[model samples]
Structure formats: structure tokens, C-alpha cells
Target: MNRRRIAVVTGSRAEYGLLAGLMRLLAADPRIELQVVVTGMHLEPRFGHTIEAIERDGFAIAARVPILEDGDSELASARSVGRAVIGLAEAFERLKPAMVVVLGDRTEILGAAQAAMLLRIPLAHIHGGEATEGAVDDMVRHAITKMAQLHFAAAEPYARRIIQMGEDPSRVHMTGAPGLDAIRDLRLKDAPELGAELGFPLEPGPLLLATYHPVTMDPTASVAGIEALLRALDRFPQARVIITGVNSDAGRDAVTGRIAAFSAGRANVLVKDSLGQVNYLSAMALAAAVVGNSSSGIIEAPALGVPTVNIGPRQGGRLRAASIIDCAEDDGAITDAIVRALDPAFRAGWPNPLSLYGQGDSAARIAAILAEAEPCLIKPFRDLGV
Candidate 1:
């Protein structure tokens, strides 16, 4: 019998990290053929050329399309999307996969979704229904939902939202967040071991892991927000911070540059382009609190029982867990939030968000359903109350 070919496209280190467990599951299935098409920051030199890490993880990439250029302006970002669409269309034509899977709402992933739509390849979108009101991702995510035939929502509310958007309820599955799978399954290193792996010593006091990406909608918030976060971190003399670089988005250079300059001579601060998934999560597992506007702090941190000091408007309107301490973009506001996160009473009473998303079985469920379910190439919109 011929195996069903499923093309999985990933555009960034963060997105690939979320898809890693599902990709591994699909690859292990005898009836399924997995094709990983890598693009975006994975190919960019400044982003650490993470495609090598993908291969090192034992997955053979079927294609590499360079979409990221050497600029972070809106015009450059627009051109990269155009390039992604053209490159992805050709990849689909060559591979001729039964279906395509994509996660999240990066501009590059948006291009892949459009290519799948024009190619008439069934597109399965994961993490589709959450809202990030401060970023263009909210718009792009809903747009991708309309194009995708299958929706693997991380939460039930998210699945319902997809159906509310005129999609057939039967095609939407609450598969939980796949990133949480790594939290439950991976043998994360302890503080000392992680320190050795990262070649940075772990502070005995509170450790804060931060990753801030540009809010594409606001554009100006990222750099200012990160600077405020740094000022906030300055207030906690005993607190240590480890920052991961921003994504390849418009105005990202400013955020990355500021983070580099801020961490230059700070003994307690460490900055890296990428730490891969395992190492980054290991750091998260050991950190006293997580800071910044990345989705990991909003989704995965709560599941891991860690406190998150989510600053700025980047994550505004996203569902919040009890452990999340949302604050403004001001330096004083961020300082207060971090101080709250480190509080023993707050940490002790923080609620787990596992019920809001799901347990660690999302990857297996998503892989199995894709292997067994027929391709949904022509889904007619199902209106609400139908």
C-alpha cells in the first residue's frame, strides 16, 4: 500500500519546537510519510541556522526555502512573504503531498497556508483559534483558520471559536498544545546540569527566562518594552536573567540590539540567538519565573507550574492562566510584576492551566488522526447552529 505523504512546514525555531513532537510521531508511523519543509529564520545566519539542529534531531528535511532577507523593515517582511508563497507553491507541486500541516501565525506560515489553498492541498492548522490582539498574528491566524480544512485547537474554547468562524465542528479537534508535550516527556536537566549545557552559571536566587518578539501590529512596542523589562530586572539585584533573541520580524533588530547592549557587561544576564527546544525548556523548568511576551510564558509556563511576568501588549487578549502576571510596558510596571512573580505566596497559590489547554498527549492524538482521517480538500462552511 502507498503511504500518505504529509508535508509539514515550519518557519521559525519556536514554531518548529512546538511541532517537533507531532513530527516525530508521524515519522514513526508506518502508514505515513512525513515531509518537513523548512524556511524563514531557520535559514537565516543571525538566527543560528537552526535547520542543522532539525537534522541533528533525526528528521530529514525534504526542502529548504530561504525566505528571510537581511532587513527588518515592513517592506522587507512583505517581500519575504511573497518569496515564501512562490517557494512553497513549487515545493507543494514537487512533493504532491496528501495534506499540509502548519502551526501558528508567522507571516511565512501565512504564505504556506495560502499556497496550500491555491494548490487544493488540505491544510491542517494547529494553534489556530487563540487571540493575540496586540499583534497582526490575530488577524493572520483567523485568516489561516478559514483556509485550513482541519483545526487542531490547543483548547476547547479555541476549537469552539474555529467552529464559530463557519468551519465544520467535526473537523476541529482540541488536541491541546503540543509544546506542553516536551514539558511532560523530556528529561529536562536540573539547574546545575542546564548551567553546564548552556555554559552559564545558574544563580542561587531567582532566575528569569525572557523571550520578546515584535508585536507586528504595534511595531514600536518591542524595543521599548524590552528596555523596560531590562530596567525592571535591574531592580532585582539577586535575580538572574537569560534572554533568547527575537524572531525575524519587522523592527526585530532593535529588540535584539537592545538586548545585546543591555546584557553586554551584566554578569547576571545571558543572551543567545537560539537554545533549541530542549535546552530552552530545561532553563524554563529551573527558572523561578519567566518574563517577556512570548507565548511560551502564556501557554507552557503555566503548565510547567512556573510564574510568568508577561509584559507589554504583545500578549494582550490571549487567555491567561492564574500563574500569569500581566503588566504594562512601563519599566515600573514590569518591575512590580517580576517582584510579584518571585513572591513565595503567589507562587504557592498559582493555578495550573493544564485544563485550559490539555495534557501531554496532543502530539499522539494529532498524528493518529491525520494518519486515519481522510483528506478534507473541500469543506463547505458550516454556519453556527447548523
Candidate 2:
């Protein structure tokens, strides 16, 4: 019996967290061969050289496609995507994997999917049909959905959405969010340990684990939005604000600059390039409230029984848990939402675990499905509902 080779592409640190469990399961499966490709910010030193994290976890990296350049301009972002497309195409051609697995709505994933489509390799897409109307990622995600041969949606509603988008129902699987699987299974470090590791004192006041990324569609608003969020943070002087770095997108400089400016005099505020999944979840567990536009606050934070004050439009239309409080980019609204999120009454009514993303077995299910499913000829634009 020949081992079926599957290529998994991880572009950023966040996406890698989502894919790590699935990669581990695939690596352990006797019938499957996992080819991991690290790209985008994973190659950058500023992002904690996250490719080392991948290797540290004992998975062999099949390829590392360097696409990000120093400049944080729109042209640089576009060129990064183009370079990823070229590099990914060359990789897929050389490896000739049975399928290429791409996740989320990043530009690098879009480039990889396009490359796979052009190379005539079947594509397996994860987390499709979810809406993020705030950024260009929404468009990129939907485009990848159309190009993919197999879809693994996080929720039933998302699965239905993919079917509605003309994908064959049989080709789409509701495997829940793989990210949640890691969250559910992993034994996170204690608050003290996590704080020591992160080199920040764990104070008793409201702990805010915030992560903001550049909204590529609203390039001008990116810097302004970070400043607005910083202003909001200023209002919560008692709270310890822990901010993760921005994603590798256009205008990242603006986001980083604001963080640096805010951190200059604030002893309670700490900034990090990347927080590994374990530390991230540990922080979420201890946090009084999560404040940011990152999907983690929208999806994973709620599952941990933590309140999330989601600032701005980046994660607008996605399914949110009861713990999330949506707010605009305005500083006043963000500050008000933080107050609401930290309220005792609001924190008392947290949603149950089952109502959240998944049951924590998504990786096993995804691995089993990939192992058993026959590689059928995928016809583009075949409406399943029709």
C-alpha cells in the first residue's frame, strides 16, 4: 500500500496553531504522509521565527517559501502574494502531492490555492464559508472555497453555506474548527508559568489579551484603528494589556508603531511578536477579557469562558459566541465595551462548551476522512444543491 502524500501550507503563526493538531495526527497516521510548507511570516525573525516552532514539534518541513519583504506597502503585500503563487506552484510541481491543504483567508492561502488549481492538484480547504466582511480576506476565503476540491467547515451553518456556494455536499465535511481541537486537548501552562515565560508579571486586575491585525481593505483606517484601540486601553489603566503582533499584511508598520508608542511609558502593557498556542490559551484562561479583532477572541475566547470586546470590523459577520461584545473602531465605544465585558453579570452568563466551535475531536475526524475518502475527479462550479 502506497502512502498518500498531502501537502499542508501554513502561512502565519496563527494559522499554524489551527493546523498543528491536524499535522500531528497526519504525521502519526501510517497510511498518510504529511508534507508541511512554512511560508509568509513563519520565515520572518520578527515573528519569533515560527518555523522553528514547527520543527520543534517534530514535523519535517517540506518547503519554506519566502514571500514577505521589509516594506509594509500595498505593493509589497501584492508582490508577496505573487511570489508565494510562483513558489507554491514550483513546490506542488516538484512534490506532486495527492492534495494541497490550505486554511483560512490569508493572501498566502489564496496564492497557494491558485497555484494548486493551476497545477491540477486537488485542494482541501479548511474554515471556508465563514464571513469576515471587514477585510479583503472574506473575498480571498470565498475564492479559495470555489477552487478547493474538498471543504472542511467549522459549523453546520458554514457547511450549508459552502454547499450553497455550489460545492458538492459530499465533498464538504463539517469537522468543526481544528483550532478548537487543540484548545480542548492541550494542557495549557498555569498563569504564573505563562507569565514567567512571557516575561510579564501576572497582575490581579483585568488582564486583556489583545491581538489586532491590519485591515487590508481599509488601509488608511489600519493605523487610526490601532491608535483608537490604544486610546481605549489608556482608559483602562488598571488593566494589564498584552498585545500580540500584527499579521503580515499591508500597513503592519502602523500597527507596530502604535503598539511601541503605547508601550513606551506603560509598565502594564507588553507586546510580543508571537505567542505559541499553549501560552495564548493560558493567557485566555486567565484574562478578564479579550480585546481585539483577531478571530481567536471571536471564536476561541468564548469557549474558554472569557469575555471578548471585539473592536472594529475585521471579524464582523462570523458566528460569535455569547461572550463576545462587538464594537466599532471608535475609542469611546471600545472603552465602553471593555467595561461591559468585564462586568460581573455579563461574565456570569457564559455559554456552554457544546454551543461553541467544536467537541475537540476535529483533528481525528479530519485525519480519518482524509485517509478514507476516495480521490474523485473534482469538477469546478458543480452546484451541490442543484
Candidate 3:
């Protein structure tokens, strides 16, 4: 009785949080052997060395690929991807899993997809067919969709897009977003508890859970965007702001520098390297609004009944819920959006926090699918007769 081996690659802390639930299900399945590949920012100290968080979660990491190093230049990112390909190639060769699974569009996953394609290991992608027009990740996501033999999308619209891209319809599954599972299962900390944990007081004003990343399409957007965001945040002095670390993109250093500098003299602001999944989601559950361009604002916040002020184009072209207030990168625009998200009247009228993505059973669905899926690298282009 040979257990089906499934390899899942996680790069950053945020991506790991999304994949963790599915990884757990896969690990528990008697018919499955879960192979965990940790890489990228997880290995970087400045990003909280988040691989330890995965270890703490009890997932046995099969490979620790250190593809990222110091420096956030475009050249550095390109070199890192190259290293990921070489390293992941070797890992896949050694593990020889029936299928390789990866989530979303990231540089490391790009490398993973390439290696899997060349190695002839069946590839499955989660969170594919989503678009982020303002970021380079949009192209990467589409590229991965083509390479993957199995596509598990977070929503119907995303699944349709995956099919539109010539993927065989039978292979695509609308399994919802696994991120919501954390919100459903975790015993999230309440406001008082979260405040105590973060060493902040949640009384007297709104609490903002903010996470901003570099808009990779525009090199100058990160510095300018963080500056504008900081200025907008200054307007709401009564609010407590929790700013998390940026992704390991090309412009990360600029954004992190600005965020650190802004939080230095501000008592109302707290800067965290990584909140881990539980504390982060717990904070979101208690936040006045999830403020940032991070996808959490667009996906998980609505499910948690929290409003979101999504700034800039980093998450552009992705589906948004009624609770999300999109704004330009300008300080005035951001301030206005934040005001809208915090408005009691607005939330009062906002519909049932309609989860555009399905409910929280995504991880279980994906795990069952992976356990039963037949691994085959030979796929034919699907055509929809007009």
C-alpha cells in the first residue's frame, strides 16, 4: 500500500498561512504523504525566519531551499528565482512526489513550476487565474496556470478564467480560498486579548491592521505609496496602526525603511516582522478595518465581517467585496477610503459580507481532491466552442 506523496512549496509567511490548512489535511490523510518545501522569505532572518513558524505548526519540512538573500534589487530577485529553479529541481528529483502543489504567484513558485514542468512531475496550482494588474505577479500567475495540470481556484470567476486560458475544464476545481479556513477554525483572540498580546490598548479608538507590499510593476510606487499611507495614517491619530513587514519584492527595502522610520516616533503605531497566522487573523477579526493592499483585505476581511481600505494597484484586477474601499496611492484618497471603511452607516448597509469566494471548507476539498487525483503530465489544451 503505497501512500500518494504530494509536495507543497511555501515561500513567504503570508503564502504559508494560506497553504497551512491544506497542508494539515494532506498530512493527516492516511493515503497521502505530505512533502513540505520551505523557501524564500521563510529562510530570511529579516522576514522573521518564518520557517520556524511552519515547524511550530508541526509540518515536517522536507526541503529548506534558501533562494533569497540580502538586497532587494531586480537583479537579486532574478538571481533568486534562478537559484530556486536549480534548488527545487534537485529537491523534486530526490523526493519524486506524484504531484507538486504550489499556491499563488510568487518568484519562488515560478521557479517551482519551471522545475516541475521540466522534471515531469504533475503540478497543481492554488489561487491561480487571479489577476493583480499592477504587479508582475499577474503574468506569473497566468504562466503558472498554464504549467499546472490541476487548478484549484478560490472562486468561480477565477476558475472560469483558468478554463479560458485553455486548461481542461475537468482539471479545474473551484475549491474556494483556503485562507478563510483559519478564520473559521481558529479560536481568534478578542480585542482585549489581542491588545494585551501586542502591548497596545484597543480602547478609545479604532484599530487598523495594515500590511503594504511593493507594487512590483512600478519601481517608485512603494516608497511613494508608503509615504502617502503614513501621511494618511497620521490624520487618524486616535487609531492604533499595526504595520506588518513587506514581501520580499524588489522594492521591499524602500517600503520597510519608510515603515520603520514612520513607526519610530509614533506611539500609536506598532511594527511587526511577522504576526504568524493566528495572531494576524485574530487581529483582523478585531480590527476596525483591514487597511492595506494585501489580499487579506480583499478576501479574508469580508469573511471576518471586517471592512477594508485597499490602497493602490498592487491588488488591482482582483475581485473585491462591497466591504472593500479601493483608493489611489495619494494620501488624501487613502484617508478618504479609510474613513469609508470605518463608517458605521456604510457597514450597516453592507450586505451579508458576501464571501465572493466559497465558505471555509476549501482545504478539506482540496486535500480530498489531491488524494484522489491521478498524476499525469500530458495535458491537452481545452477549447470552448463559441
* Angstrom error at residue 95, model 1: 0.7
Once fitted onto the true fold, the runs of candidate 3 whose alpha carbons sit more than 4 angstroms away are: none
Across 53-96, the per-residue lDDT of candidate 1 in tens digits comes to 89999999899999877789999998999999999999999999
Model 1: residues >4 Å from true position, as ranges?
352-355
lDDT for model 1, on a 0 to 1 scale? 0.89
lDDT of 3 by residue, 1-386 (tens): 89998999999999999999999899998899999998999998888999999999998899999998569998999999999999999999999999999999999999999999999999999999999988999999999999999999999999999999999999999999999998898888887888888798776668888999999999798888989998999999999889988999999999999998899989999999999999999888888998878998999999998999899899998888888898999999999988888889888877775678889999999998999988988888878886
Task: Name the best candidate (by TM-score).
Answer: 3
- For each candidate, the alpha-carbon lDDT, in order, equals 0.89, 0.88, 0.92
Model 1: residue 174 alpha-carbon error in angstroms: 0.8
Q: How does model 3 score by TM-score?
A: 0.98
For candidate 2, the lDDT comes to 0.88
Question: What value does the lDDT take at residue 72 in candidate 1?
Answer: 94
Candidate 2 — which residues are off by over 4 angstroms? Answer: 384-386
Selected candidate, larger TM-score, 1 vs 2 = 1
Give the clashing pairs for model 1. none
lDDT over C-alpha atoms for residue 80 of model 3: 95
Q: Identify the superior model by TM-score, candidate 2 or candidate 3.
A: 3
